[model samples]
Target: MPSLPATLLAFLSILSLVFGGKVLVFPLDGSHWVNMKVLIEELHTRGHNVTVLRASNSWYIKKESPFYTSITVYNSGGIEKELFEEFSRNILVIRRQKRSFWTKLKLVSEVGAVFEEMHRNQLNLMGNIFENKDLMDSLQTAKYDLLLTDPAVGGGFFLAYRLGLPLVLNVRWTMHGEAHFEIAPSPLSYIPVPGLELTDKMTFVQRVQNILVYMFSKFQKARTVSKHYRSFCEKYFGSEINYKAILQDADIWLMRNDFTFEFPRPTMPNIVYMGGFQCKPSKPLPDDLEEFVKSSGDHGLIVMSLGTLFTHLPEDITEEIAAAFAGLPQKIIWRHTGPRPVNIGDNTLLVDWLPQNDLLGHAKTKVFITHGGTNGIQEAIYHGVPILGLPLVFDQPDNLSRMKVRGTAKLLDIAELNRTMFLEALKEVLYNPSYKENIQRLSKVHHDQPMKPLDRAMFWIEFVMRNKGASHLRTQSFRMSWIEYHSIDVILTLLMILVLFCVLIYSIVKCICLKVVLKKKVKTQ
Candidate 1:
């Protein structure tokens, strides 16, 4: 006969399987996949069955994994590597130009066009999926407990709605703008919008500028991105279905940020902050890397990386950076993939990739040189490392601006970068003790939470699965019209009523006064 403990263990395993939920993940590729994979691995560990929907030409998402089964859809042309590369090249060239009103206007227009094309491609893919009867039937028959996705792309929102599944978002942004602006109450008077690079406490002029930028972004979004999704919704769904409203109706938002990194702002109950969820303590470095770190001795190390997309700068810029690194006392580990710079320093070690989070956590690490991606910024904060930021494009400058305001980072304009400027900026971050103290304070606050960010995210995901939906947590404000939500209609109605009451009182008094005046005149005669 089998041992009692062995039999009990087997029975418990089966029970866990019975209770496990099915999660259908519609994910964005590239760095977004990096964090989504972390969440998928944790869900797998907890006995959930995860199925990922990926594009046929995906850059980062793998076809097979033990954690989840992937469903590859035929992607025509949307969010490909070449597209981003071209965009990056264009942005760099524009940024290198002298700053002017035209330069800024051109940059904004380029960004709007690029995002519009990306979203259009995503919508086309979703349309194909909907048109394919066999695929649609299989997806429907799977009986998934809920759909989890990153709202940076809109396909997930459409898919969840079509399947009638509770939607959960792995989000810092949506198709229109920041997730909070779409779902939560954002007062622009305090909550600075993205791209403006303003802090919470702004001067009167800055606040006025903030409102203007917010309005401009809305206008740009309406002109460029909204029409495509509007048509897509009308074709598949009824004309009455509002795509933006669907985003607001999502069951849970696993926001990839928290107050430690973000300025304090009004937020919603369903928007759960999971910043640094993917960050963990350092592990032992590979043998060669460890040997290099040991060679640095007491001077510590400077780690440099420009996120996933832009691996290297232009040749001259790279040479300038390499020359600057040569002058530093600290050993350097830089993630560079370009042709070796002739001015490359003996103290610098160049690699195609590095263990980013693990390296940031190392005790010998003194400063981080980054492109200011959210993931990299959070990891730096988690490790209490100060930053020398070279913000390239998109939200990089904005994100670095926040870090600069917090006194834990210094931002350098890549457009005006030279060896001397780069060297001075690096020295400033390294020699400054206040930068270290400020980042460590943030790290302490980030670590002092009741539960780890990953765990909190898991609880909400499972909670949605157990209940089939988190409707109670979701506010119905999305269903309200713009005029109703802002109470503009109510205010106008109250003003009209007051006006009518005043008119009536004035007419009655005038009639009584005239009658009394006529009677007095007749008696005198």
Candidate 2:
């Protein structure tokens, strides 16, 4: 065999790279970057081009033309629903602060109504998806083949639908649960329990308000999703569609769930399970960070981070966390993004940001006090570090709830933060061999998959794009109406009819017997 010349080799490499495809990933969720930061880099190394479109948080781009073709929205504060969302978030914060059931119910109801009205106005979310025209144009100009998205917050899904490219939804930690799975037509309630954000000891009124609010939002998005689903079908593929059809036709679905931590879903060729995408050790910690870890040595460090969104934490909560950390014998490194926790002692370090995954991988790192984000859980498990989950909102509680049951992590109430509880939890996690054993055990399971998630994700994407829509592979179940999707009532009706028929037959037999007895008595007389 002749070795190719260097020029020929370079030319062939470039040719092979073209068909390898490019992914247009829109990170609408603030953590989209945090979650996919590693995955995209990996894809890039494997002869794929990855371009990130910054997402904007708004229903529509008010400006006719913008600087970038794609918008990445989150923490940009451009959300069209900003006023209403703030109101809703405020309701939770104030309710937690005031501790009034009636007041909370009233506020929740009002917020739910606002959600409905917002839907009526045809506003979905204020993000890149809502105003992704430039991305749509790129579909015509650029050879981008796939739209990779977490899909909860961005315009990538909509643009993918519009461009006739395959759409992939990454099950990044449950921002709102799997309800985002329904493609927005049916309802947000379509999301499974694992994906929902539920309150503890909720009242009936609270539940009513919660359902109403979610319905209002779901219905609002349904109109837009349905409208786009139909329009994109004809424009891109010369087809028409409904929500279920769009959902079923998705080329690839990536979930953060893994066999390591949870029960398995029946595997699908179209689905790639990549639950710990966030936790993969991608890079070496900087010299500064490595030195910090080396300095800890055997003393063992306890790491704490509230995750990205809670930078606006009240001073009181920060103070409580500080008190707890100060009381601990172990060194504490808190990823305090906003105001530093009050009164830091010598054993604690307050940094705006740290290499979270690298720190977890350190031998000196023992215990993790985390906000219980799925990303953090994957990292903790990856490094065999036990965790104390102090969940604040959304899926944090659920993640902790499941992890605690799995025995890899323990839970501490966010409302009940203090020195004793904090110190005790940290000490227990640091000293306990069982937590480490459990995490390592789970780590094996999480890694036991046949292939890494990206390979599977890429394959399915290319497969669908080549197939020009895998309509043949889809199940007819996708066409089912809402009535059929929830068929318990229909089953109950059939059962009731069967029972009534049996009762009627028994009554008829009793009447005939009574008549026969009467005739016999008359004849005897």
- Give per-model CA RMSD: 2.4, 7.2
Per-residue lDDT tens digits of candidate 2, residues 1-525? 555797788777787577566777655434545556565656665566666655244343321222223434343433244564465356446534543567545654654454344322222332333355664565558866677766443345555666667677675432223532443232223222342344334466656656776675466445544454455445544665443465456666676766565543344545566766656554677886666666766777887786766544567767767887777666777887657666566678888877788788877788888877778887887777888887665567677776786778877765566667767876777778888888888877767778765566556656755665565555454476767867877988999999999999989999999999999999999
lDDT of 1 by residue, 3-63 (tens): 9999998888788688899999999887889989999999998789999998898888999
lDDT of 2: 0.61
Residue 371 error, candidate 2, Å: 0.7
Give the per-residue Cα lDDT of candidate 2 at 194: 40
Off by over 4 Å in 1: 1-15, 507-525
Tell me how far candidate 1 lies from the true structure as C-alpha RMSD in angstroms: 2.4
Lowest lDDT sum, 10 consecutive residues, model 2, at 60-69
TM-score, structure 1 vs. true: 0.95
Structural similarity to truth (TM-score) of each candidate: 0.95, 0.71
